[model samples]
Target: MKLSVSDSDLLGLVHLIRLYGKNLSKTWSYTITHLIRKIHDQEHFPVTDMVKKELNADSLNKYQRQKLNRRLENDSLMIEHMIAVQSIINVIMKFQYSKNDNDAIRELRSILEANTNCIIKFAIKEKDLKGI
Candidate 1:
């Protein structure tokens, strides 16, 4: 599906990439790069060559580089899963901010609670597959 995010959400995601792109673990940095490409259609947020160069610096050991390269090779699936997880997080955040009298919050809370077990199962499966 083609997903469209708000400007604020896009900026928030970009800020996250900028803030933690270089500092994250190798796996996470690769994931973040996939997210950046998904959202911005470039390997780096803000589409800057300098940021791309920094992110792709030759600092990784052979194994780490291989892992990162593997993730990059499967970028489409990584982006899809990241987007799905990010959507769930956004919904949870929205529910958290709902007003006390909001009926939508009650409904959403019930839906989320009902799906918690299924979500946990999926998470476990993903963890087993990716060791994440």
Candidate 2:
């Protein structure tokens, strides 16, 4: 689906990535985790609390199971948004960490732009234009 991300959301993401890059001493895993948490924290979905409860449950009642399943579908869709952004960042980081290869940088830039567009498309697909 063609998702359309808002200008603010796009700028926010770019700013976040740049901020994270300032701390180059951090590992990629740590940076990605922080980014994911930041993204997840910025949005509030009513079903999120229930989903968390269901996740922690030892056994789900029929109603809870059904509700959790429905909510999870939405959650998974949002997760795709996160994954798309993370993937793009990962590619960009790889380029940054690599030897200065113009060819590699060009290839990575193409991939990053494509993935960034995908994230924007996913954002547009969301019921509310609030990005991931």
Candidate 3:
């Protein structure tokens, strides 16, 4: 499957790669390089957000608010969870799709992806995987 990114979003990714190259994987670096080369090849294809277009704010009622308050008060458990997620990712990332990386990636991606207007999405072709 092919994915297209906007000049605005592409510039954002370029900025992130510039600031955090050490944290990014080779697959990401290689893909971003390709994206940069293909920037001029862009078409005006409108991309949609990967999230629900509308959210029901009515769900945030009294009970939900109370539960949220309790969760915020539970610092020890949250800290332990953070530590576990940190260990899950490792000092240097080995693989981004392993079981150990799942929870860490899920939580971080949940927040970031949820907030993204439109994200750059891609699948590494099998032939290119080994090289990355």
Strongest candidate by TM-score? 2
Pairs of residues at least 3 apart in sequence or in different chains that clash in candidate 2: 3-120, 3-121
Candidate 2 stretches greater than 4 Å from native: 22-68, 71-86, 93-113, 116-132
lDDT accuracy of residue 26 in candidate 1: 65
TM-score of each: 0.22, 0.30, 0.22
Candidate 3: give the clashing pairs.
none
How far out, in Å, is residue 81 in model 3?
47
Counting only residues 3 or more apart in sequence or on different chains, how many pairs clash (N, Cα, C under 3 Å) in candidate 2?
A: 2
Instruction: Give the candidate order by descending lDDT.
Output: 2, 1, 3
Model 1 residue pairs with clashes: none
RMSD of 3: 17.7
For 1-132, candidate 3 gives per-residue lDDT tens digits of 132444355445434444555677767756654543343134221211211122222223224433444654322100011122223223223323323334544433443323222111112211222110
Counted clashes in each candidate structure: 0, 2, 0
Candidate 2 lDDT: 0.43
Candidate 1 segments whose C-alpha is farther than 4 A from its true place: 25-132
Worst 10 residues of 2 by lDDT: 116-125
Quality of model 1 by C-alpha lDDT = 0.36
Give per-residue CA lDDT, model 2, range 4-123, as digits (tens): 333444444444445566565557556655654454334332333333454654333334444555765444323324335556566655544333344444444354445532121121
- Give the Å shift of residue 31 in candidate 2: 8.1
Worst lDDT 10-window in candidate 1? 116-125
